[model samples]
Target: MSAPYVLVLYYSRHGATRSMAQQIARGIEQAGIEARVRTVPPVSTQCEATLPAVPNEGDIYCTEADLKDCAGLALGSPTRFGNMASALKHFVDSTSGLWMSGALIGKPASVFSSTSSLHGGQETTLLSMMLPLMHHGMVIAGIPYSETALLNTQTGGTPYGATHVAGSDSNRPLDEHETTLCQAQGRHLGQLALKLQD
Candidate 1:
């Protein structure tokens, strides 16, 4: 069989969520698994149109194949009124085929998010993402209390998933707690995936 990989999928308009994806990928790799980072294009209100096959910059667009083949998943997005952005949601909505086929059943999945404010619905956004993954029969994972960062975070860490307070300017870098929580979530998901594979 091919090597195992954790799919780190996300959508970022202001770069904050993208940065979190990178950190999560780092932790995934640290757990001795490959990290495949991918992103989805934004949806336009204009008449039906599709994005180019390949993105011009940043991570490549995600394919259903990537989702099906991944051993684990780390999904991220920028919060939009306590929910995931439409772009990421659109991508997930297309995965009904995977759900129908039970292709993702039993895989470990985690979530992360970025918000413009400290309480900009980070937890709600994370939970919203988890709902679809759970429907696909994926096992949800989250940062546990053992991850010290969860207890120390004054900004974004939560029992639901990793998160970041990007502030209204979207310029505040992730604080130490946020970084540690992201890494912890990645490591937890990676380790669980490895265990499941065995």
Candidate 2:
């Protein structure tokens, strides 16, 4: 068997969510566990248009095996109408086999989101992401109140999960508080994963 790792899987449209994923991965590594970063390809409304097997740039695509074998998971996505983007949701929906087998049962999982506006349903989106993991029987982890960033964050940090406000143009970067919360969530999940394995 391969060494256990946390899967940092996300779907990024403007890169803010992707940046948060990287920070989460850093925290997982800081916890002395491997972090496997992966992304899903954009979904097109038109069925005929398909993405290449490999993305031209950025993180490689996530595979079923990656999801099945992870020691823990950090799922992220851009908020769309108070929910996760279709691309990430599509990937999650494809994991029924894992769900049926309970492959993720007892594993730790957390969620994060990016939105173009501060009130763009960040918490709801985080909740939406959690539903699938719950169905798979994964233990959900969230940013705890003890994290000072959650108390002081002016931009984006929540008990549900880490978040980033990307501004209207989706050009805003993650603020210090947002970044800190993301890392904290990752580290907490990693620690939980290790302990649960014992």
Score each candidate by Cα lDDT.
0.92, 0.92
Q: Write the per-residue lDDT of candidate 1 for residues 1-198, one digit (tens) a residue.
A: 899999999999989999999999999988989999999988887532455767788999999999999999999999999999999999999999999999999999999999999879998999999999999999999888998888888999899999999998998899999999888888888888899995
TM-score of each: 0.96, 0.96
Compared to the true structure, candidate 1 yields what TM-score?
A: 0.96
What's the number of clashes in each of the models?
0, 0
Please give the TM-score that candidate 2 achieves against the real structure. 0.96
lDDT of 2 by residue, 1-198 (tens): 789999999999989999999999999988889999999988777562366767899999999999999999999999999999999998899899999999999999999999998899999999989998999999999988999999899889899899999999999988889989989998998888888874
lDDT of 2: 0.92
Task: Please report, as a residue range, the 10-residue window in candidate 2 with the lowest summed lDDT.
Answer: 45-54
Cα deviation at 185, candidate 2, in Å, is 0.8
What candidate 1 gets wrong by more than 4 Å, as runs, is 45-50
